[model samples]
Target: MADITHRRVRTNGIWMHIAEKGDGPLALLIHGFPEIWSTWKHQIHRLAEHGYRVVAPDMRGYGDSDCPADPASYTILHLVGDLVGLIDALGQDQAYVVGHDWGAEVAWHLCLLRPDKVKALVNLSVPYRPRSPQSKPVEYMAEKFGDGFYITQFQEPGRAEKSFAKYDCLTVLKKFLLVNGPDLLAAPRGIEIIDFLETPDSWPSWTTEEELQYKAEKFRSSGFTGALNYYRAMDRNWELLGPWQGAKITVPTKLITGDKDVGFQSFGTKSYIESEFLKGLVPGLQVLVIDGHHFIQQERAELVSAEILSFFGKRSGN
Candidate 1:
């Protein structure tokens, strides 16, 4: 692994800490919620070795980045703008953008908002879901799957945050990383990991002691407020993106989802995403299914990097 240098870049009224390595065509990598720039550790060195400048940032509230108090500050548009500003700060006109989870949401918005700033896009775990004019996020979820219990929990301001704080964020993190289909099915009323965090001893064997500690310690540095804020900005993001609801993204786009990941199956949006989101909204888009869960980038780093490199290389004619 190559040494990663850390630098602070000012964006969206906060100083974001970015880890960068190598030098070739610039590649901007953004990490999702509960993860910092370190999430791209494996890819940074690998991409750098493959002759690309890899830059990964701890967005807004993660790692060494500044955490703002207001939840509205964490809106998707704001997050995406911070990334665009980071690119300007680095003096790059545009770069190949790759992101996972919430980072994927930002990447999608960036491509939609400013196509010139993005050479190509690689999104993992989360697919592009265009907002409908008549549908509220909660209502949309409920219409499809009766009740969106997860989004409902997040709608509560401090409930999930308090639960994560109580468990020291380890219990929820462990369950998120390791829970399988059988465990999910065995639970009677849908397994809410936040509810289970109240008792850490009941945490399953999916994550080892060391892995749990690593995540817990990272959250300890800033607590769960910053991460939770991302969820809190749903309404604000919808408001900001009202003008872009029906916009079609023209950039080269690649969507990667983990096969076993519950996100695709959540409210049964997998087929909807393929038929509606990608094919319907974005033009010239490709989808890739990998074997894993939500944290596919971390679980399958080399494969993810290869896919990203291949997509960007082909687009760049390299």
Candidate 2:
């Protein structure tokens, strides 16, 4: 295994921590909710060995990065700004951006906000949801998925945060990282989210106890508010992105997801991914369905990295 390096960078008015390795065209790996850059532990070394510099950041919060106190500071614009600034700080004009879950959402918006900064993108979990002209994201989610929907539950500032805090950070990370299937994620009122884990299986065989603890210690020290704030600012992002209505991600792209991942099970996500809905948003997009869980990158790191390396190879002619 190749050793990874760390650095704190000033970008988009905030300081962020980035984990990176290798020395070639930059590949910025952005992690999603309940995870930090360490989530790409497997990809960093593998992708680096494939001759691409891999840089994974903790985003604004969730790890050793600066956590802006206000939830409103977490809008899509803020996210895109952080990434654009990151590339500048890295002394590069562009990077092949790879993201998962919320990171995927940000990557999609990053392509829209600054296509010049991203050479290509390969994302996992979330797909590109075109800007909606109907209702605000939070209200629409509450109406369609009900208040018990996890996003809705997180809306009342500090509500879900307090609920999540009741569990040990390691326990919370284990539950969120290990979840499977495509059930609409929700938390009943008054129940701590950790209670929903059901049974904690022995740490997924892919990651060791030490690996889990490195992630757990970050959350235990930083808490999860910065990460959860991404959810809290959902509607604000919708409002802020009004000008980007009907925008399509024109960058070279690919989406890989576990067949049973919750995002795939969502109402029509699977069909859409395989149909014109996804292609309409991302023309020439490649989609791969893997037999695994939502955390596909970690659960099936080799396959995920291979897909990424293959995608980069085709895109960059490496």
lDDT of 2 by residue, 61-154 (tens): 7699999879989988999999999999999999998999999999999998899888999999888888789889889888887766778887
Off by over 4 Å in 2: 188-192, 314-318
Clashes of each: 0, 1
Q: List the residue pairs that clash in candidate 2.
A: 182-262
lDDT of each: 0.76, 0.86
Q: lDDT of model 1 at residue 297?
A: 75
- Name the 10 consecutive residues with the lowest summed lDDT in model 1: 180-189
Residue-level error in angstroms, candidate 1, position 289: 1.1
Mind giving the per-residue lDDT tens digits that candidate 1 earns over 195-287?
543234554433357655765777788777887788778766777789987899888999988887777765354686668446868887898
